[model samples]
Target chain A: MVWALALASLALVSPARQAGVMRGGAAAPSFVNAAVARAPRDGAPRVHMASCAKLTEAAALLDSVDVFIFDCDGVIWKGDSLIEGVPAVLDMLRKAGKRIFFVTNNSTKSRKGYVGKFTSLGLSVEPEEIFSSSFAAAAYMEQIKFKASGKKVYVVGEVGIQEELDLIGVPHIGGPADAGAQIELKNGGMVHHDPDVGAVIVGFDRYINYYKIQYAQLCINENPGCLFVATNLDAVTHLTDAQEWAGNGAMVGAIKGCTKREPVLVGKPSPLMIDYIVDKYKIASRNRICMVGDRLDTDILFGRDNGLRTCLTLSGVTTEAKLLSQENQIAPDYYVGSIAEFAGAGVKA
Target chain B: MVWALALASLALVSPARQAGVMRGGAAAPSFVNAAVARAPRDGAPRVHMASCAKLTEAAALLDSVDVFIFDCDGVIWKGDSLIEGVPAVLDMLRKAGKRIFFVTNNSTKSRKGYVGKFTSLGLSVEPEEIFSSSFAAAAYMEQIKFKASGKKVYVVGEVGIQEELDLIGVPHIGGPADAGAQIELKNGGMVHHDPDVGAVIVGFDRYINYYKIQYAQLCINENPGCLFVATNLDAVTHLTDAQEWAGNGAMVGAIKGCTKREPVLVGKPSPLMIDYIVDKYKIASRNRICMVGDRLDTDILFGRDNGLRTCLTLSGVTTEAKLLSQENQIAPDYYVGSIAEFAGAGVKA
Candidate 1:
């Protein structure tokens, strides 16, 4: 079978596998909470149940789990600051000697920035405790042994990516003038005007205009073998003012959705991030680990896809309404109104 | 039976005794055209082939079909005055004694503005030929006998909606504060502020800020019995710069999507417009009517849902890729490269 069950916590797995947990009861630890099927209505899309009890039950099963994974945006904070009681919850977790990690798919900020943010927000967090998609992307380039000593790779993202590439000593170029650099490279021809582009790496470039999208598409099309990497796969970025703007995820999706080729993801729930966290921390049994997040598509999905206990908070992206509607999607092992509730009540094993 | 085949057409008609026509066999004098299903695809949404094919073929069936319905924004000119041979096609149709009816769900522009736009585009059209959501909404108020004689009916749309209420002699209040003389009423007691508002009329408001949406929601929540009317149901609006902007449909959907109450639609394919057109023009039979448009959900669906022919054009919103993917949602009767092709090739009937 193309699908197989992993005998571990649902929180540490991939997003796709995490959504598949509602199938067999015998495979799981126990069927503590199950969503009920709703009756169909006339002229309305059929909706399925996503119960809060299911998340609570999952939390109960992974009481003393070791590792803790957290998503930054929509989980802890919308952008810049932390949600209510986030600092206190983290302090309690640290006091309890629980191993905590900040696993974010956002490729914009560097680890130092994340550490700075946490410190500024009155939370004790170190640079080593943070893991971003930019780090994973740079590592992928290193693993592939990509040659970029003299040639440039078009950078399309933020400071985190630039920092990662700088750490790896990789040279990259970007701009409207450098747009035709890829086509020039294909014909064994070096660009006479600005000839130094070897590959194209698409990241979250906030100041995106029409010329940028067109140039990026052209560059990628010209050089088929050129490296193309997308930092993360988030369609919309939630902000504080309830203003939702389309993120790089949608652009990446438009490009990858149009083109059938899957880009190598390097963020949380990609198995890459989980593996990095597990191996680096030397966390011995994967079953002892638990991942807490607010978004189902990213956080709970990351846990379920991996082998960690997944706890979903109602304070973020997927609300009670969204959860109640999502039937077969990622079901969290524990459902808490806020992270503070989990820390205070202590998940019972 | 709930679903049975008609003996004359062998077409599957619902138990409601909806009007249907016979397919190919004996050529009846009244027969305009026949609809057939396109080849099926795996993992595709299920669209009744007749639904997609009937509208396009309907154009050929009529003997001088009155009121040629054209969906605006996406179907005709999007954003600015940029369209692919639409103006020329309209000119040709007008010369051939076809009464061009600009039927749109867009409640942004007034009839005078639309008439002016046509004149500027070299297409001689009158204000009476335009049928917009505002006009349909006015008709609905009259039909429902909504009594709002001195009471303030909060208008959340453009000047066109205000103009429609003026024509119908409905005492209305509320417009942008910037319009000193036009400001008949202040913000009502809704999320935005205006209290004491009797009803809510949702129109195409481009200057929608957070305050506006909040106000609208607040108003609706305050008055459960307040009437909610949406001019159209378009998901995305295509702009001249090849950009997809949020149309009133999404806003309408957001309000409805957030609130469980569904708004009454006053635009095309709702049977209201078709009835108004037929009654106003005194069209002998519905069989002679054909709906020509670029979008599938609104334009083509109008024909399919109402037992008329629909023609899908590539010049507007629904492209070939969208058509192939949107098989399950809505389908057009005939696929044409552009209106130019449809107009150039005379109706075979």
Candidate 2:
């Protein structure tokens, strides 16, 4: 049950209004129509527009601004296309001198992929301004000063984690067969005695096998404090069509439960991740910054704790079905149809 | 580590003097000293006593008292041996006509075990007056109408769970290897499959095996709504001796992580568990309850959420080490050496 049900009541609107809004011609009716479509279904609980109103209220509460964060996939576009007038709205925000940073929990792709996404969406985004949990994991390794000199690191991730470690001059220890390599879980690996390996890094690896989980557990158990790092708390991964599948979060959750230790979550909600972003952007004040994401638990909670305004768009991750069931547990301040909805003139105030 | 350090500090004093004061008596000193000796040596930030003081102040601010709750184990004794003055304390409370109930998260042991312990300690206690997570799990299963009849139920627990199921008249399916019988995961089977089994019941099975886990997963995975139950959530269990080990909480946690479905928690701290206790005993009111336990995470959290005043004793699971750890999240209203210390007459309110 996506927020699409919210538009049920507004379904009575004239086809002209729906078309106008869909075409990005009218701002107010466009948002209203989208909200109506995304609201809860009839006979079910009506949509709580408090989240939509929360964004406005939260923005008003802020006295100053620092880093304006944007979650790419849901907020900017669905896939290959931009959401209505998102490009123009982003341009307007940039012209208004708002410092924006693209923040994503996705670790499968590197900065290059994010840059490519911006190019495809017709939004001007710099690679340097993009932050991924993969980057955070790499930064954590560096912060802790793990031995990375020609150290073989195993990878259970896509190019994102591999690239980050590469950029930092960490050698990729391919598999258990690569005897001298540092074992990276989430990739393919088996049990072996490698005294040369300094740490086992966990990242978003799509090709996760049972052997990887078993070997990873063995490594962590054998060498206590072998630097077990996780890319994000994303239990599920985003599909190309916007669906979610099991990801690193699920795998890490298994290990954490088994070990009875919460992983050093190096993702969107962790203070460490936010600190990295703030430091990278040199953001002095966090008062006016707004965090935009589809996840209420991680994104909204992060914003709420960090004193940043939060905007929850119904474009990804959480659906109305999830919201209705978990209303008390996971809640964001604001709701928006899409990033494009913010293009309206009233969005400024 | 354990409140033992504090107890040791006061151990040199006379027992009569100890009975006269709230803490710092000979008995209190011994209890605290024992705890300290058993606790980890590494110094960590302890939970501020001020928070406990604040909770006490909060209770003091309350206008009335209706019920009094008590925690088992450390508050009473370590296993069969009664804490120094627990018997006298209960007698006094009983004589005063104050309502009292034993609250414990020890799902490994049954209500009968607890009743027998009290009798051995020379204190009179009714089965109805005692509440354990094991009993709670059984009652919950019954309330939920878990196996009407001829239901081949898998039992992975001790005699308590078996007794509950038997009393409910639910036919027990033999072990996984037995024809038409589903071996309970807690008993010794990890993963088993039998077409005839109707449901899987999880309780505290000390000898949980890999096959049991795997079989439970298979049974649950095969049937989406197949009942998965847990006795309680005391992450770790404190033995009669000083050492602590992983309890049913960890096993439940494993199953939950694998299934992605939350288990129905039957044990203490659950509202349903609390209700079962209340109904069985027909407690008049809930106002004057004071719950005493060694752990704030389990017992104290239970008391806090359930409108009961909580006291933390330093004889079991929680040691001074945890108190010193900055990461330990929960706190209690009062910190005493033991129930014997609380039973003493001269402690200032």
Instruction: Output the number of the lDDT-best candidate.
Output: 1
Cα lDDT of model 1 by residue, B1-61, tens digit? 1111212222443221133332321233233234444444565444243432322343443
DockQ (Cα-based) for each candidate: 0.03, 0.04
> What lDDT score is found at residue A295 in candidate 1?
74
Off by over 4 Å in 2: A1-66, A77-84, A120-124, A148-152, A174-190, A240-243, A319-333, A346-349, B3-261, B264-349
Write candidate 2's Cα lDDT for B202-287 as tens digits.
65454443345445555665654577777775555544333233455545654564456677776666667556655676765543
Q: Taking chain A by itself, what TM-score does each prediction score?
A: 0.76, 0.73
DockQ of 2: 0.04
**Chain B of model 1: TM-score?**
0.77
Give the local distance difference test score of model 2. Answer: 0.57
Off by over 4 Å in 1: A1-63, A71-97, A104-110, A131-284, A294-307, A312-349, B1-67, B72-100, B105-107, B133-272, B275-284, B312-349
